[model samples]
Target: MSLYRPHKKGTTPSGYRGTVVARERDFTAPTVQLLNPAGVLRPTPEAEPYLPLVEALPDTTLEQFYRDMAISRRIDIAGANLQRQGQLALWVPSHGQEAAQVGSARAARAQDHIFPSYREHIVGMIRGLDPVNILSLLRGATLGGWNPAENGNFHLYTLVLASQTLHATGYAMGIQFDGSVGTGDPETDAAVLVYYGDGSTSQGDANEALVFASSYQTPQVFFIQNNQWAISVPVSRQSRSPLSLRGSGFGMPGVRIDGNDVLVSYAVTRQSLEEARSGAGPSLIEAVTYRMGAHTTADDPTKYRTDAEVAYWAERDPITRYRTWLEGRGASPAFFDEVDAEAADVAADLRRRALSLTAPTREKIFAHVYSEPHPLMAEELAWLDAYESGFEGGAA
Candidate 1:
């Protein structure tokens, strides 16, 4: 029998049992969309001012956007496969949210800092992180861990939901304290961009971060990728109000955008970060998008959502819609073909590398416990060694 099936009647309210999706509230926030579902280059009225930003982009940069999305999907696929094949402990797929990740990631200036809630693999890769590091983490082989300074200021992922909001806010405050923001010099000025999910909005840490971020007028942008469902729970069940309003509630401007539209994501984030770095204070952006896959390798989305809903989103796949726009731009078939070939290569290489990663040593766990060595850690390591040495032919 299948482990996860749709709920019939008379079951409990939870995954693997039954669900009661009380969509008592619906969010109908107006969103800025530069590209429609048909891949047309028409912008909504709200997106008019930002049209020039997209137009001003060189063809090469535009092409890079598509490349990044394509490659991210390939790597995401590889991650899922690795998890299923028992090569990875778990996998968090960013399957359907490519445009939002790519566009927003590209919008940040080199001087800015970013904090990602796990699942933003592409965002880290864009900030000069090797995808192998991500795979290594999943493969249970990370030792010292990645350094943000060496990786374009992209901080490591915080697995705790909504915790990164505070981390990002704290960093922004540090930037302010150092007089790195509002200096009127774009090159020297910096800001913070933090990514969180729709569900995280309900977390106390997220709201508290907002409180501090707004009160201090921190140089930061709160980018909420509202992908409809926060894990298996719908956003409507959590809040009747539009998430964009969250900005206004916190004394900041809130803007909603079509997260699937790369143009909208890039233009709006670029403008928000600019204003932030220039000392205009913080802002909130609600990127309305969807996660077309299971929440994680362990999840079964089919158990909670319907087939029709999946079909509807599949029609609006970010990669497919973006490719349509690129085609309208007269991109050659060879360019697309080359991208596909490269994506295939990337996926294959990731699988090969992921399999090669060895497990981390026990000593590595104690190494990062503190900046300076601790006597307790040394004693514990010795105890662990003696305990393991009791086993036959053990290195301990």
Candidate 2:
């Protein structure tokens, strides 16, 4: 017999359900989903107001959203395969969160600055950074690739949990000081979007960043992609209520959205970002998505999570649902075939680029840390050189 009692057919699973704000057509309750899982373009009560924005998107842009999400998923899968094949030192998979990443990323305008919390590969790609730029880091070729200023204002990936939140806040403050926010010029005025995970919310740096953002009224959005797992720790163990409520305590508005629905993600993020840019202060978004894979190539999800949980999320696959909606809207099979072909080409290119990457030299690590020579660094370099000289393959 099953240990747990099953809920009704339309209700969410026990642990995943939140306070019902409003019911959808299917009678389920949880985060906001503009498009239902069945691929119908049904807007929830919270998302109804944004229907015009969603409808305003040109057909080409809507198609691009699907293409971008498809390509990103391919890139993520390729990254994992490369790691398993020993081509990459480690890989962070954003498997089921493509809708969350791509939707919010596509919402940003060119002048908007983005700060990513390591796994936002799709976001980085949307901001014009080469996908290989991220792979190069995982391949141990460089600390980071692509200059943020030149590469569409997308910052380097921050692996240290929640540290990027502070960096993003500081940058947003600078944007404010420079009279960028609320300038009434969309082209010149800028806002910042920073991503972190649910686990990062518990970090002091993230809370501190929120305090500063609220205090200074910085034009920014703190996007928390609550993927339900902090390494091996479930979000239920970390917080009592929704992660979104944490921002409200800091005087910033917070909204929890169904991260699996691309439409809601795009609309909400676009709305939040616009509010921030217009000097309405910062906003927080808790995207309720599932990781759908091991946290990284080094992790083993089977050890902590159950197969049933995985299967549950699998049924709500963002790509498949979006494809259904697109088809219902008269999207041709030829278009999907073309997207598939493009995804294949992107995967091939990524594989080629990843394999081509060369590991950084030992001495190169000593550079970039300090602007001027320091005694401790010099001594360390000397020690490294002397230590290496003892090996048969030591460099001169």
Candidate 3:
């Protein structure tokens, strides 16, 4: 039996489960969308100033955007398959989020820092991180595989849910302390971009981070990829209104955009990050997208969602829509074929690296518990060794 079916009218007080939350009124908050699901480009008044920016982007760069989305989907599939094959301890699929992540990541400058909430593989990919680096984490080979300071300022993936918002806010404040903002030097000034899900909007840490960000006027953009479902809890349960409205309450401007459309995602993010970098305080973005796959390798989304809903989103597939737009723009079949071949090569390489990863040794867990060793850590380590040595022929 399907675990999640829509409720009937008058079945509940709010007509949606038994809660008396905000009623679903007229959907007045306009969503910025440049490309429709039919693969046609339609101009929007809110997105006007940014359309020229998209046009000014070189054709090579535009083509690369599509390539990034295609390749990231390949990598996402590889990760999920590797988990099923027991190569990875866990997998967080980014199957349907490539456009939202890739578009925004590309919009940020190289000098800007980024904070990712575990599932942003494409964002990390754009910021000079090899997909293998993330595989090491999911495969239980390392706590963190790459150095954030040296690797294009992409911070380590924070899995604690919404905690990265505080970290991002603090980092943005540090940038301010270091005189990195309002210097009239775009190259030297730095901004921060942090990614989180719609579910996180309800978390205290995320709200607190926004409060701090607003108070300090931090140079940061809070990118919330509202993937509709937060691990089986629909976004409807999280907020009564659009998630972007939360920003206005915190004294920052907010924007809601169609996350599946790469054009809107890229254009909106560029504008928001520019405002932050110019010392105009923080901004919030709610990118309306969907997670086509399960929340994780362990999740069975079929239990909580209907196949019909999934099919509806599949019809609005970001990659498919973008590919259609590209074809209309005369992107040759040869280029598309080449991109497919490149994605296959990337997937193959990732599989090889994922299989080659070695599990971390038990002793390695004690390496970074603290800056200096403590008596408790020493006692635990010694006790662990003694217990393991009791086995026949075990290393002392």
**Which clashing pairs does model 3 show?**
none
State the lDDT of candidate 2 residue by residue for 192-309, as single tens digits: 9999999999999999999999999999999999999999999977787888888778998888898998888899999999998899999999999999999999999999999999
Most accurate candidate by TM-score = 1
Give the clashing pairs for model 2: none
**Ten residues in sequence with the least summed lDDT for candidate 2:** 22-31
Give lDDT tens digits, candidate 1, residues 1-396: 977776657664363565567865654667899999899989999999999999999999999999999999999889999999998888999988999999999999999999998889999989999888888877778732599999989898888899999999999999999999988997999999999999999999999999999999999999999888877899887678889989998899999999999989999999999999999999999998899998989999888899999899888888899999999989999999999999999889878877887777889867868999899999999999899899999885
Q: Which ten residues in a row have the lowest lDDT in candidate 1?
A: 11-20
* Every candidate's lDDT: 0.91, 0.90, 0.91
Q: Which stretches of candidate 1 lie over 4 Å from their true place?
A: 1-28
- Please, what are the lDDT tens digits per residue for candidate 3 over residues 122-155? 8888999888989999888888888998788999
On a 0 to 100 scale, what is the lDDT of residue 43 in model 3?
63
Deviation from native of the Cα of residue 284 in model 2, angstroms: 0.7
Regarding lDDT, does 2 or 3 come out ahead?
Answer: 3
Model 3 has a clash total of: 0
- What overall lDDT, based on C-alpha atoms, would model 1 receive against the true structure? 0.91
Using Cα atoms with residue i matched to residue i, what is each candidate's TM-score against the true structure? 0.92, 0.89, 0.91
